[model samples]
Target: MVANLDASSKAGSVLIVGAGIGGMGSAQLLAQMGYKVYLLDSAPGIGGSMHLLDRTFPTDSCGICIMSPDQPSYCPTLECGMHPNIEILSYAEVESLEGEAGDFRALVKHRPRYVDIIGCNNCGLCVEVCPVERPDDHEGRLHEVKAIYRPPTRAVPDTYVIDMDYCTRCGKCVEVCPTEAIDLGMAARRSEIEVGAVILSPGYRAFDARIKGEFGYGYYDNVLTSIEFERMVSLTGSTQAHLVRPSDGAAPRRVAFIQCVGSRD
Candidate 1:
């Protein structure tokens, strides 16, 4: 897939790893200036850690509202969404690299889309019809998601993907899809690309709040990280952004925001 694109792009090819906020910004600037940019990431899509958090602090404003909506949104959280010129490869990875600056060969590994991107209308009927439901990783397992789902309402490219691991091969998504977009037989693909420069922007990882045993992060339902708390506060979130204890389903009156759990070191 990458090779097909590599051959099409003109001079000044740029390979960008980690399609986070920085990567998207850089790709747009370069593409607008007449550069053929190749953006890749190991995750299913871009948005990086930005999608995990609910909103920015201090003002308590919704991150999605403040961010630009013109670009493709990775999830419903408005702050992280769209960009026109960026070629996004979610569920992709880089296998190898060769050559040098001004011309480097990159081997890219692409996972199957499972659901057809072109035909599907994003009506979410497949999700409603499918029987299998799994942990919603976007919500940090706080809720369950259908086998097929859009990353969020704001997701760009406006497509839904199938969860091969959880999909029961029931063909429900395919049957319900008005556009015949579901294709369960797609396989992983590999391709190569040649680029002049590679910009790596692999972002940061969230510290496991479970490490601090005192808070009982994994054991108790009330305790959560900043990101989890943010989702709990979001009306679009799994819980409809309600701040309640998962164990009891009651709203929490006394909440503690613990800073520097891991960063103090």
Candidate 2:
């Protein structure tokens, strides 16, 4: 929920360098205490690592993994990105940070999605018309999603983005957008904003098992990372929400995961 747009930032605003769980949760807490927050992430949607994982820990519960459902709690999950005080800047990378502790300016490079965030309503028509397909990174590349797509149906911001790098500029999506939100010519925009404080949580990447070679990560299709395995078992994962082996696309009777493979963690 958003506070008044004109609620007034008496305490000044804070620029959060990442919209992951850490940055978003801090934004929500600070916002509740009366401070404007600019939440930024380099991805097309919020949730960061939370977005890729199919389920939460312990029992694979998805309760708070997706978007927060307007609840009342102090949960420090990435769901706080939906708060009104947090102005999410997805697909934005922070270029530089200037100034001292309390007064800082962040220079952000915003890559264009070619779709107007304000006008688009997350309709799947553009996806239906687009002929290009790519490995779904959100599903840990275990499956495919449209080149023009949203990371997840329940993803925050609820908007679609075009992977311009992989997109063929087919213009088919441009023609099919119902809200006229698709713009094939959108350019990268640079923005600078001032804030009282900065919180950096650029997020983390899973260890590349391919480099280790012992795990046969890239060599063996059957072997997968936790994130990839998560996608295989996730209710929202790419395998029609069911578990399946990647190599043969078969259901394995027994699954085994070695703890801290190639690491001390």
> For candidate 1, what is the TM-score?
0.84
The Cα local distance difference test for each model comes to 0.70, 0.74
lDDT of 2 by residue, 116-171 (tens): 98999877899898888888877665778888988564556668888876899879
For each candidate, what TM-score against the reference?
0.84, 0.86
What TM-score number comes out for model 2? 0.86
For candidate 2, the per-residue lDDT at 62 reads 60
Residue 142 of model 2: what lDDT? 75
In model 2, the worst 10-residue window by lDDT is 1-10
